[model samples]
Target: MHRNQGLYNYLNEHSWQITEDWYKLVNDEDSESIYSTTDPEIIQSLKEQNQDYFQHLHKLFIEKEEDFFRDFKIWSEELAKDQKHLKTPVQYVVREFMNSQEVYMKYLKEYFSLNKDNVALDQFLSWIDLVRRVVNLSIYIYIEEANRNTLRQLIAQKEIINELSSPVILLRKKIALLPLIGDIDTARAKIILENTLSQCADLRIEDLCIDLSGVAIIDTMVAHEIFHLIQALKLIGVRSTLCGIRPEIAQTAIQLGLDFSHIRTTATLSQALDRIIAD
Candidate 1:
């Protein structure tokens, strides 16, 4: 007989009962948690997830420790990525895992009491150790995966914001407006340069007015990128005009020794457009 045969049988028979007990005792007061959800579908999904966890967990009694933990890792990773669990506050999720640990501890004691003659002290202690190790490791893995998901989301959002920040609007036939606003960091400037070039090509822009009136600050690197963008536009058969060059930005450009002799400049968007119409 397997060393933990009786314990395995006991857990298998009581799996549903354990899941029900866990659901009844769960604290879902946090409004951010899926556990606090009112939708019947979500609630039912939550119960099913709890039951699934128990189905994986009870195998520890019968399977080799290494095999059980390997399977548990797969299960834990899935939980970390679960749409409902991901939306839930991490604290609430971890709290439920701890609660499940408490339930396991309770059942361990009951199982021992019913079979004390056969359950040795060493075996009982080993099971306790295994339980604690699994719980701690599960929490660690969940938090690690959760952090990765958050970082992915942040990167995706930043990409969208970057695209939105550098928009090229068509002002007229074969003419377009590239309006730059806010602080121009080197990273953002690179995206602007790439996006502006792509947009000008797509719009078949001949005369491009880059408006910088809304921009509050510019560093040397950003100033360089702007010139690079204008030079890029010229290579793509687009005529470039710089408008609304603020005093601070001009000073930064001058300090960088940028040659503006060949560059077109205007004090306002209206003036730039008027110049384009006259030409």
Candidate 2:
């Protein structure tokens, strides 16, 4: 039982005591019998209610604390496995949080820190907010990595297309060799040009061998794009060499009056490689 005088003194600084009428917890329900009793019963009843409220509050505070650590533990484990999934700023924030000595230090400290001298309830609440941010940051990184993996799969597909662009006895310089497969249409041509040009530029390669070995037809647009890429390469100081143009491409080239004079032509990738290697 809280002594009326003592309980009042102990809770003198507490806002709950001042705002006693505001609480449904303490004032809720029929406490009239308890509130009405004289002497020891009234005081005892109020103390019991106070104690019960304190007990419930204390338990909730403890559970909240445990829950904070629980969230932190799960976040830490996942963060350890996937840090890149975290926000760039949050990484530093977490590092500071973990390195705090007055806070949860060591590995925990390195992840987060708080100054002990300024330990206040508000500060503790802020720390929890930061902890939640770190967890969210880790989740973001995980999603980013997952998205990147999917993109990589698509990139691998492009790489495969590049390989087929040219038929070769050998592959060199990480060129996106595209041996034309299936439909050799205008759409395919555009994709090839864009992909090839992008790879060549990104790689900063001087020599690109585009072998039309598998092209079903030597269409007007395909020839135009090939020459276009060749010119783009020259402008960028990259040299594009055509290889594996069967009789069909030659005939089409002649028929279209397409000038192959500025472009180097090779019968096969082997010949192109040999010439490039020689140069």
Candidate 3:
């Protein structure tokens, strides 16, 4: 038998034992909550994943001269997307990979101690190098997937926030209330303007009560944007009523020489509703 084949047979025979040892090592050092599960099914699933990884790794060792293992690469990508792995802290995943390498190296050392005459030093070194390359590839794929998942979550959160910030509540037929709250930066103001116009057109809102009681300040540019938003609503056949303008915002608007003569103003949302009801 070839020297490489002998090594492969040894690894294949002891694969289960190595997997159990690796699991024990990871379970004992479970600080990141990745493998510290009480559920039997979860524990079994983790063992299965580890076993699959080792099996793929063993195939690579048997064919060390190959440029890449397409099957293993595909499996690694799928493993990266696994919900359990995705939820696991990345540092824990990295440490687990390190732990597996250490286990395999220790097993190889033990195997060669008794059969040192059977394996060449160069072949042993090559196997160690192959293990290192596979671990590195797995780490790279895991990190890339984690980053992509994080970015997706951030985008989802932003969309939810935008929807919440510019909510158009329909209080009556042909009437809606848009209560502006918190700080309105340029980006948020733009979102508010676009969402408001789209909602008004969809709801066929004839009168929109825009309350600014929650808003504390508005610079000239923001004030202009608000004015432009109102003008845009008018063009879309929606009459926008400005309400709850704070003293500071109104003063800024005056300083900018913005004419609010054509725009209807209300002191409160209830009063705006009352006027709409009375009219």
Candidate 4:
């Protein structure tokens, strides 16, 4: 059994060489990727980040497996959160990781050829395995973090759309209009309920006209949410009128055993507005 002291020394000494070789072959032509940037600062930052990754990865040759991976996680997270890397398409990032891995493997083979008499075959294979693990773990962590970023953005966008879709436009002093549009799923229905109540309270609305004419579909859950919204408004001392109820929506509301006896109903938004003005 041969100690891999020589392998470790070689990797540490020539780490920068590995980074340079990897950068030379990096495929950065993708228009949508951050790698395609022409800014010299961004290009230099990319090089520094890649070199840092190599700095953490090559320590696997001398450090305990647990310690190596622990440090690698930190590096992977920083890379994942780097604004530039995050903007780069994940597939392109993955391709570059593989390219860097190839560079390391090439260097390892070079080192082996030069010290073939001193390095054992099994030690060489073990080193290969360690290098592969480092690259694989790096890819795994980066992808995981990227997915989390994507999910957060989606949630934020959904919240914004929900807030905009259920806006309470002020018609007059203490009078507001909520014109529901698009299909309403349970999730969106919940947001609508919360936002409508909040906006009405904020505007100190006395009467709210909820128009559903532009709404394409209102499933059982959504119909129930609308009912709850009117009920919630009454609790806040805000009166609500149902307007522009399409025939299908009306049927769905009726079929769901929704009680609207105490609520005011109108055939169109104009009629609802007229009634609000009269009151």
Candidate 5:
């Protein structure tokens, strides 16, 4: 109540103008309230009170923003624990909220105690609604990424699932070492191709080493798809050298009568690295 009296004083002093939010808080609702009904003595007192309110509220926000995040981190964690166990970064939460272009005109009006005017309040309310939507979208992104990561883990758990090596860089070159861990279908192969190609442009990578030591088998169609990826990379100025081909996988290539068709094949990553270095 005292704080309100202080804010009222401050608003009255400025003719209801809110400087920070550019809102004429005092004059926004009614100038008559201060000068028409109230005496000059009462108006003078209100000004003094509002000055105190401004100082206190400014201090409060400075203190509270830090605490709000700390509390939010704790609260979000608690909420996540009771849910399906999806944990997201608090950084994401705060960033999404802070950068969210949502400014609450309504919140400003309410904070200023200009509640009687619905038209002015609507503008602020609309701003709040916009920010809320942006925050929700940001959250969705975090949740989706978390779920994708979980799915990737599950897939990697099966012994039959082959793990592809991440693209290793060498000699200012991108050597995509697809050391097949388990299996290679058109789908996984497509993912590997996309991942490797994505790195090529950024890294200015020249050599791509597609290793297949952990992979034991490949159908003719898969082989053709691999050939296509190499060709595509070659067209984009990325030289692909398929490395770490286990003997069994080589035999599959031979038994299936799969022609590599200009795709460079190597026995090991060491050999591939050495060759790229020599080049």
Candidate 6:
């Protein structure tokens, strides 16, 4: 029989004992591990996952076939995306994999000692290489999946922040209030312009009161974007009224040679509201 086949058969026959001993070692060393928790369901689930991993690992060793490795890769990818695994820290997962590697190596060493007449040095070296390859691939998949999950979360958060920063609250049937607060940068100005125009169209807002009372500073680019937003609103048949234009902002707009004669201005949101009511 082939050396790999002999090793595979030995491991497959003792898979149950290996898994049990591996879990015991991990639990004994890692008391705070999610797998070592007292919850029966969680513990059972972790056992099942470990068993699945071992089954695929055994197949990979026995077959040494491309399809077996492909299936193992797919299974490892799924495990990486698993909610339970994702919740665990990457360090903990990595440590667990390292422990499993140690356990497998110890078991193989024992197996070699018992079957010294049958197991050759080259065969032992081949088995070690296989173990290293599997462990390295598993770690790579885990880290890649974790990075993807983090990136997905960051994108979701950015979308939410963009929406919150450019809110349009409807005060009346045809009037909406867009309160602009904080410093206006070019990027934020673009988001503000796009979201406000889209919301105004969706809400059928004829008059939009843009309150800038909380805004502290504005640059030339930001002032130009504001004017562009007003022009865009006009094209879509929504009249924009600028409210609470602080002295600094007004001075900056003037310094930039921006013409605001076509845009309506108010001292406060209340005055803008009064004008809307009178109209």
Q: Residue by residue across 184-246, what tens digits does model 1's lDDT show? A: 887898899899989989889899999989888766666678889988898999888989988
Error of 4 at 117 (Å): 1.0
lDDT of candidate 6? 0.82
lDDT for each residue of candidate 2 in 209-255, tens digit (9 for 90 to 100)? 77677676766777777777677667867777888888976888898
User: What is the Cα-based lDDT of residue 240 in candidate 4?
Assistant: 92
Give the per-residue lDDT of model 6 (tens digit) for 36-139: 57778877777777767877787765674567668889889988998777767788888878878887888788888888898887777777778778888999
Q: Using TM-score, rank the candidates from best to worst.
A: 1, 4, 3, 6, 5, 2
Model 6 segments beyond 4 Å from truth?
1-3, 27-33, 65-67, 183-190, 254-258
Worst 10 residues of 3 by lDDT: 60-69
lDDT (Cα, tens digit) per residue for candidate 4, span 49-165:
888888877777778777778878887777778766777789999999999999999998999999889888788898888889889988998899889989999999988988999
**Model 1 residue 80 CA deviation in Å:** 2.4
Residue 154 miss distance in model 5 (angstroms): 6.4
Off by over 4 Å in 3: 1-3, 28-32, 64-66, 69-71, 255-261
TM-score of each: 0.93, 0.38, 0.88, 0.92, 0.41, 0.87
Q: Report clash pairs, candidate 6.
A: none
Q: Is candidate 4 or candidate 6 better by lDDT?
A: 4
**Which candidate leads the pack in TM-score?**
1
Query: Whole-model Cα lDDT per candidate?
Result: 0.86, 0.52, 0.83, 0.86, 0.53, 0.82
The model with the greater lDDT, 3 or 4, is 4
Q: Candidate 1: deviation at residue 98, Å?
A: 0.9
Superposition error at 52 for model 2 (Å): 45
Model 6 C-alpha RMSD to native: 2.9
